[model samples]
Target: MIQVRGIHKSFGEQHVLRGIDVDFHEGQCNLIIGLSGSGKTVLLKSVLGLHSVDQGTISFDGRVLGDMGKKEVKVLRQEMGMVFQGSALFNSLTIAENVRLPLDFFGDMTEAEKDERVRFCLERVRIDPESFSKTPAELSGGMQKRVAIARAIVLNPKYLFCDEPNSGLDPETAIVIDQLIHEITHEFGMTTVINTHDMNSVLEIGDHVILMEKGVKAWEGTMEEVMDSDDSAVVEYVFRSNLFKKLRAALKKA
Candidate 1:
C-alpha cells in the first residue's frame, strides 16, 4: 500500500498541493480525478518522486520516501513502472528493444536473458513475437500502448503509475485498455495509481477515487459510493450524464 500524509508542494510562491492526504491501496485502481489545474498532476508527480514536496510524507508500505538516501531511492524506483501519456516509445527502436530498455538499464541479465524476458513480457500483454522486429511507426496507437504496458511490467514492478492512460484512444479502445490494465494490476497485486479525467474509467475500474478541487482533497470513496454520492460538486461534475440531463429537462417541462 502507498500512504500519503500532508503532502504539500509549491512552485516558488504558488502553492499547488495544499496538505494533501490520501492512501492508494494495492490490487485496485486508485484514481485521481479532477478538473485541469486542480493539482492532480502535481500530486501524481510528488508521489512518483519526480517532484519533491515542501512538506509531509509519502511512504511505500511504511518506508518513508522523504528520508531515503540516493541509493535507497534508486532501489525504490526499480520497483516502479510508469506508463506515460504519450506511450513514450522510441520511434527508432523496435518493439523488442523498447521493452528491453528498462531491463538493459537496471537488470544485470545477459543479452539472451534480456531477449527472453522481452519476448515473455510482450506475449503476456498479447503482443505477438512478429511485432518484435517492427518499429513504433509500424503499429497502431492501441498496439503502441500495449507495447508500453509490456515494457512497464517487464521490470516486474511492484507499483505502477499511469498518467492519462486513455487520453488518445477511441472510446471502445479506451475501455479495452482500461480493462486490460485493471486485470493485469490485480493479477500481480501491484500498487497502481492512475491520473484520469475519464468518468468511464472512474465508474468501471476505480476501487478508490480521490477527487481534488483547487488543491484540496474534496472527496474519496469507492466506485459505487462515487456514483451515488450527494456532494454538490461531484453531482455537478457528473451531471453531464445523459440520464440526469434528460430527467432535468422532463421535470422542467412538466
Candidate 2:
C-alpha cells in the first residue's frame, strides 16, 4: 500500500496541492480524477517523487519516502515503474529494445537472462514476438501503449504509475487499456496509481477514487460510493456528461 498524508505543494506563488491525504492499495487501481488545474497532476508528481513536496509524508508500505538515503532512494525507484502520457517510446528503437531498455540500464542480468525477461514482459502485455523488431512508428497508439506497459513492468516493479493512460485512444481502445492495466495491477499485486480525468475509466476501473478541486481533496471513496455520492461539486463534476446525466435521470425515475 501507498500512504500519503498532509501533502502540500507550491509552484512560485501558487499553492497547487493542499494538505492532501489518501491511501492507494495494492491489487487495486487507485484513480486521481479532476479537471485541469485541480492539482491532480501535482499530487501525482509528488507521490512519484518527481516534485518536491512542501509538506507531508508519502510511504510505500511501511517505509517513509522522505527519510530515505540516496542509495535507499535509488533502490526504491528501481522498485517503481511509470507509464507516461505520451507512451515515451523511442521512435528509433525496436519494440524489444524499448522494453529491454530498463533492464539494460538497471539489471545485472546476463544477455540471455535479459532476453528472456524482455520476451516475458512483452508477452504478458500481449505484444507478439514477431513484432519485436518493429519500431513504435509502425504500431498503432494502442500497440504503443502496450509496449510502454511492457517496458514499465519489465523490471517486475512493485508499484506502477500511469499518467492519462487513455489520452488519445478511441473509447473502446481506451477501455481495453484500462482493463489491461487493472488486470496487471491485481495479477502482480502492485500498487497502481493512475492520474486521469476519464469518467468512463473512473466508473470502470476505479477501485479507489480521489476527487480533487482547487488544490484540495474534495472527496475520496470507491467507484460505487462516487456514483452514489450527492456532494454537489462531485455530482456536477461527474455527471457533466450526457451519458451520466441520462443515467442519473433514469436512476431517479426508478
Candidate 3:
C-alpha cells in the first residue's frame, strides 16, 4: 500500500497541493481525478517523487519516502515503474529492444534471461510476438500503449504508475487498455496509481478514487460510493453531463 499524509506542495508563489491525504491500496487500480488545474498532475508527480513535496510524507508499505537516503531512494525507485501519457517509446528501437531497455540498464540478468523476460512481458500485454522487431512508428496508438505497459513491467516492479493511460485511443481501444492495466495490477498484486480525466476509466477500473479541486482533496471513496456522493466538486466534474447521468442510472439499475 501507498500512503500520503498531509501532503503540501508549492511552486514558487503558487501552492498546488494543500493538505492532501489518501491511501492507495495494492492489487487495485487507484485513480486520481480532477479538472485541468485541480492539482491532480502535481499530486501524481509528488507521489512518484518526480516533484518533491514541501510538507508531510509519502510511504510505500511501511517505508517513508521523505527520509530515504540517496542509496535508499535509488533502491525505492527500482521498485517503482511508470507509464507516461505519450507512451514514451523509443522511435528508433524495436519493440522488444524498448522493453529490454530497463533490464539492460538495471538488471543483473544475462542476455538470455533478459530476452525471456522481455518476451513474457510483451505477451502479457497481448502484443503480437511477430511485432517484436517493429519500431514504435509502425504500430497503432493502442499498440504503442501496450508496448509501454510491457516495458513498465519488464523489471517486475512492485508499484506501477500510469498517467492518462487512455489519452488518444478510440473508446473501444481505451477500454481494452484500461482492462489490461487493471488485470495486471491484480495479477501482479502491485500497488497501481493512475492519473486520468477519463471518466470511463474511472467507472471501469477505479478501485479507490480521489477527487481533487483547487489544491485540496474534495472527496475520496470507491466507485460505488462515488456514484452516491453529493459532493459538489465530484458531482460537477464527474457527472455534470447528461451522458454520464444516464450511465450512472444504468449502472445503478444493473
Q: Report the number of the highest-lDDT candidate.
A: 3
**Shift in Å, residue 115, candidate 1:** 1.7
Could you give the C-alpha RMSD of every candidate to the true structure, in order shown?
3.1, 1.2, 1.3
Give candidate 2 regions above 4 Å deviation: 252-254
Each model's total of backbone clashes: 0, 0, 0
User: TM-scores of the models, in the given order?
Assistant: 0.93, 0.96, 0.96
Which residue pairs clash within candidate 1?
A: none
Model 3 bad stretches (over 4 Å)? 249-254
Q: What is the lDDT of residue 233 in candidate 1?
A: 68
Q: Candidate 3 residues 1-254, lDDT tens each?
A: 99999999999999999999899999999999999999998999999999999999999998999999999889888889899999999999999999999999998999999999999999999998999999999999999999999999998899999999999999999999999999999999999999999998989999999889999999989988888877888789888889988877887898
Instruction: List model 1 lDDT by residue over 1-254, tens digit each.
Output: 99999999999888999999899998988999989999999999999999999999999988899999999999999999988888999998999999998999999899999989999889888898889999989998888988999998998998999999889999998998889889989999999999999988987899899999889899899987776677976776655688765654575577
Could you give me the TM-score of model 3 versus the true structure? Answer: 0.96
Sort all candidates by lDDT, best to worst: 3, 2, 1
